[model samples]
Structures are given as structure tokens and as C-alpha cells.
Target: MTSTLFRALLAVLVVGLLVGQSDAWRRRRRRRRCPNPTDALSGAQTAWDATFMFECPGAQVIRRIRSAHCNTVEDRVWRFECGTVPGVSRFDEAFWSAWLNEYNGVMNFQCPFNAIVTGFRSEHRGNDRKWKLKCSKVNGMTTFNHAQSNYANEFDLPGDYTVPSGYYLRGMHSFHDGRRGDRRYQYQICLIDLP
Candidate 1:
């Protein structure tokens, strides 16, 4: 009877260990698929360096790339230095250009403020579209003022635009003058964080 009881206890102990290990593995897998702010910015050690790093609320890890675009997956922030922005396919770009042109190069898009600006893609792609800074903040809101003429080839704004308080920069898009069929004119999209 003593030996049998001992064997039973051993089996239970082994089963418990296995169950605990399994649960731990599952937690790890889930973390990899969905990381919080802490996980996304895990290795950041300093404040904004005025070049790559920027100050983000509750972000434990922060990184930046000068001439690249941000590619977010799960809790990881990756960079792509290729021609067009990573994750944005060529098909999507063509569609956007055509649509922006039709709409007089005026568009407004917003995203959540969960992730701050890690980098920006300023390289002009097709349709002779380029980055332009119309305006940054207007009455506590980020606004993109459409230019009267879409013929400007490059950024001709008065100065660099900065994000206002409680706001963050997301991304940018270009829209050509859809009315005149002019490839030289396009609306420079300024994507911002939604309230």
C-alpha cells in the first residue's frame, strides 16, 4: 500500500509540472502575437535624440529610421527602406493616386495615438508627388490644408510642421490634381492621430 501511494503522488507531481510548462508556453506565444506598449518599446534607453528617437508616452522601447517607413506587426515595429512604404503595395498606391486626383488632391485620414512617429518616407514615388508641410496644428487639431494649385513639385511651405499637444504624426499621402489631369499637382496627405 505504501509503495502504491508513493507512485500515485509521483504521477501527480509530474502531471502538474507538465501542465505548468504548457501554460507558460502558451503565454509566451500569445505575447509574441500581441505585444503591449512595454513589449513594443522594450529596449529604448534614452530620450529623443533629435534624429531617430522620439519621446512617446508609455513607450519603453523607441527606435527610428531616417529614410524609411514603419511596418508594425503584433508588438514589433519594423522598418523598410525600399522604394515605396513597406506594407503599402503598388496596387494601393495607384488606387490612391487616381482617387486623390479625382478629389482635387484633398484627403484627410486619421489613426489612433497608440504608436508615435518612429520614421517617415519622404521619397517621391510615381506621379511626381512629393511631401509638403501645409500645416500642423489648428485649434488643438492637426489639419492638412489643401494647396490651391497641385503644380508644386516639392515642399514649399513656410516652415516645418510639428505635432501639437495630445497628438501624434502617423503617415503622409500624395494626391495629384485630378481635375486638370496634371501629373505635377497632387495633394500631400498628412496622416495624424485621432483624438
Candidate 2:
């Protein structure tokens, strides 16, 4: 009986160890993205993980969403405002303008200089509701910090940003080696727009 118990315990230990190792491996794999095949082999990691959604009165809609995971301390969620457009909050064009417009944000793992993600959504049309979320190293600064957002917008804005209702809910991910100095920093930046 003693010998049998010892064997069962050993098996349990082995399985637990395997499970832990596999979890770590999966996280490592998630930290990688399709950046040029050669570049990936050279040592590439996800700079940031982010998304954007469209907001409206009826229901919260998801616009555009993308994630770039990396070797970080823990998972997080976030939200931000990407500015707004005039005379077209009800239409999709406003959302697209927020995307195509340049000089909006920065690309760094830790934003020491104070950068922000503005997730703008049309709220009651006249309200022109927009919220701004600043990226920080503390923890849980935005909405899309996790796999999903409770305040996700109405729906993804349709493509073709040239027409009257043409709009694009834009989302971007920026990554950097948080493990630079004495302490290695590994994190992702996420953003979700409102309706």
C-alpha cells in the first residue's frame, strides 16, 4: 500500500510540473507575432496588445481590435480616446478619421513621457462622447487591458473610409523590451473605442 501511494504521488507531481511548464510555453508563444519570417527568427516579441470598439446607444459595439502579447508581469485591460470628427458622429467616417489621422500616439513599452489612447465614440450624437486613457506602468489603466472589455462599443465601423459613412475603428499595438535595464519590462498596450 505504501509503495502504491508513493507511485501515485510521483505521477501527480510529474503531471503538475508538466502543466506548469506547458502554461509558460503557451505564454511565450503568445508573445510572438508575424513580423517578417526572418525578423521573427532573429528574436521578435509582441510590443503591445490592443483593440478598439464602436460605441452607440443601443448596444456596445466592437470596431477594430488587435493584440500583441509579450513577456510581461501580468495581463491587463485598458481604454482611451482617439479624438473625434465634426458633423459625422452618427456615421462611420468619424471613426475612420480618428484612425487615418497621424501624429496621434507613441511607440514605447513604458510611457514615461505621458502618452494616451483616446477611444472616441458617438454618444447620443450631440454629446460627441469621447474618453481619454493614459498609458501607465502601474496596472489596469485602460479598458481593453484584458481579453475582453465590458464597455466595448456597438459594432465595428464599416470599411471604405472615403464615402460619407465610411469609417474605420482603428487599433494599434506598440511593443518594446521592458527587460532593458536592471529590470526587464514586458507588457502590451490595448485600446478600445466607444460608440
Candidate 3:
């Protein structure tokens, strides 16, 4: 009777360990399936307002100046652009002005910059509105460059500039701002490249 009881206790112990291990394995799988969104950014001091990062699918190539342009793709739900330069120091003030455009109320850049030197301008035509985000290098300065447009206007814009150390180029755009209105769209450009 004693031997039989001992065998029964051993079986119970084995079954308990298996159940516990199975639960742990399940938790690990779940974590892998849905990783933390910020895990993609290597040097973020603050959390991004939005969750669920869009997969930026693109390839980087080396090319001469004035030879390539950063292009974006627009699907039914999102629009995005991304490009990479061989060196971060390649970007300069002239390159910003020549490559990036500031017309009406939209500013475009061929690659990410270290900062925004000027405030953004917003222009509107009927139901369509455009918000221009300028790039800069100096810190702690707030100024505007464009005149007031007849369209809807917004000034004093701030954004993530000054590329963090040990990072590179990335840009993203999405139409789903997770809002409940017609203005539920967002555009993002950054210089956080992680391995």
C-alpha cells in the first residue's frame, strides 16, 4: 500500500510540473506574437502618441546627390515614405532647402533631418488642409518663415527633431489617426534605426 501511494504522489508531481511548463510556454508565445511597439525604436526618450507601428517596408541604396528622390506609397488606408543616406553628416542647410520644399503650406524632405529650424504653416482649401513641418538644426528657437495663408492656419508647431545618437532614417504616414472624424490622418518622419 505504501509503495502504491508513493507512485501515485510521483505521478501527481509530474503532471503538475507539465501543466506549469505548458502555461509558461503559452505566455512566451503570446509575448512574441505581440511585441511592444516601442521595441522597434532604439533611442526613444518619450513614448509615441500612437500604438501599433506600421511595418516600414523599403530598401536603402547608395546614390549620388540630385540622383535620387525619396518616394512614398499610398494605399487605401495609409501613405508612407522612407530613404537612407550613407552618412548622417551628409545633410546640410543647402541640402535641406534644395531637397526639402516649403511651398504654400507643405514641406517635403528627401531624408530625415536633425531638427526643425522653423515653425510649420497650415493652409486650407475648402475641406482640404495642409500642415507644413519645417526641418532645422539649432535648438530652443521658435520662429516662422511663411506668411499667413488665406486658408486655415496653424503656427507654433513642434515635433521630434535632433536625431538621437546611433540612429538613421525612417518615415511613416497613416490615414487612421484612431480618431472619429475626417481629420484622422497622421504623418511621421524620424531617424531611429535599430538593428
lDDT, candidate 1, 97-167, per-residue tens: 11212223444332222222322312222222232221122222333432222332322211123333322
lDDT for each residue of candidate 2 in 29-78, tens digit (9 for 90 to 100): 77653244223222221212232343333212223332222223222122
Which stretches of candidate 2 lie above 4 Å from their native place?
34-195
Q: What stretches of model 1 exceed 4 Å from their correct place?
A: 35-195
By TM-score: ranked, best first = 1, 3, 2
Clashes of 3: 5
**True-structure lDDT of candidate 3:** 0.30
Assess the local accuracy of residue 187 in candidate 3 as a C-alpha lDDT between 0 and 100: 29
Cα misplacement distance, residue 107 of candidate 1 (Å): 28
- What clash count does candidate 2 reach? 42
Q: Write one digit per residue (lDDT tens) for candidate 3, span 110-129.
A: 22344422222233233223
Report the lDDT of model 1 for residue 102.
Answer: 25
The residue ranges of model 3 lying beyond 4 angstroms of the native Cα positions read 35-195
**How high is the lDDT of residue 132 in model 1?**
22
lDDT of each structure? 0.30, 0.29, 0.30
TM-score, every prediction:
0.23, 0.20, 0.23
